[model samples]
Target: MQKSYEEILEEFSENLKVLRKKQGLSQEFVAGIELSVRNYQKIEAAISTPSLRTILIIADGLGIHPRELFDIPSLKNRPMVKEITTRNRKSAKKKTTKK
Candidate 1:
């Protein structure tokens, strides 16, 4: 079955948000670089469909390759492991020290 245009746009928007977050940037920051706060927000919210040139501009502002924006993965739904604690590290060091 073919996907609807809205669905495709939504997915693209989601991927854009993920890429922006991965680059440690806020919408305000991206807007500053792109020179339009409203435009950035509209793209992120999927309220307005972005042109290919606009997508490329956004990707450039976010310091990512344009191809990265459309490379969304389905297996990223798994929970990520949090950082290790100092106590956990100490325990691990002790185990390794004895072995």
Candidate 2:
């Protein structure tokens, strides 16, 4: 089976918090440089998903590569991780096939 959208976001959010805390950085300190506190909090809360640029900025703020943000081993396999990405597969295929 495939993963659902919500599951992915929830995992990403959890990963973000874990990575941040593991580095001993404060949310305020990280947000002050490239993002607003509210926005960072929202991402950590899984209430909002960050764009590619935001992800890069966040990774930079954390002193790690962007890919490290998604270093969760559980994010792989199972038709794209658990079942959070299944419904979007059709739409994603459409984008690649259209052009």
Candidate 3:
């Protein structure tokens, strides 16, 4: 059977864990520079998907490009765009506001 999106995310998360550990960085250290402990744990636990910013943060923490997080060979075939801007967040929030 083909893998679902969740499955692909799980693989990405696992790859990140191995990469982070290989760099000898603890989760706490990564969380400090990247994301909250709860959020980081969720990424590892596959409870919540990571955003582009989170991926960039993790990549920076690991001293690698964000694209390296993907383990699937196919994923590398396409360009991964990691766009993180405060404007996007604000626009998303604005969409939910009562007119």
Candidate 4:
């Protein structure tokens, strides 16, 4: 089954929090550098969808690769990752069958 947009947003928010805490950075520290406290709070709370540019700024503030924000290690066994992994395996099976 596919995840709803809201579900994905929730996952993203959880991922954000996990990564931030893992690095021992407070929300204030994260916001103080490049983003506003309110905006960062909203994003982390899953209350808003950030633009691509905002994502870039966030990744920079987190001192991580931008893609890491999307593919979180803590969420590797979560719904989104499971769904994607299942889909990829299905695709690979199809390719092999067609060969």
Candidate 2 on 10-55: residue-level lDDT in tens?
8888999999999899888767667999999999999999999889
Residue pairs with colliding backbones in model 3 are none
Give the lDDT of residue 30 in candidate 1: 73
Q: What TM-scores do the predictions have? A: 0.65, 0.73, 0.68, 0.70
Q: Which has the better lDDT: candidate 1, or candidate 3?
A: 3
Best by TM-score: 2
Candidate 4, run of 10 with poorest lDDT: 72-81
Lowest summed lDDT across 10 adjacent residues in model 3 is found at: 75-84
Better of 1 and 4 by TM-score: 4
Candidate 4: tens digits of C-alpha lDDT, residues 1-99: 556678778888888899999999998887766689999999999999989988888888889988988884444466776788899999999999998
Cα lDDT computed for each candidate against the true fold: 0.76, 0.83, 0.77, 0.85
Instruction: State the lDDT at 72 in candidate 4.
Output: 44
lDDT minimum window of 10 residues, candidate 2? 73-82
Better of 2 and 3 by lDDT: 2
Scored by lDDT, the top model is: 4
* Model 3 / residue 29 / CA error / Å: 1.2
Tens digit of lDDT per residue, candidate 3, span 1-99?
Answer: 356678788888888788888888888787775489889989977888988888888778777887788866445433332234556777888999956
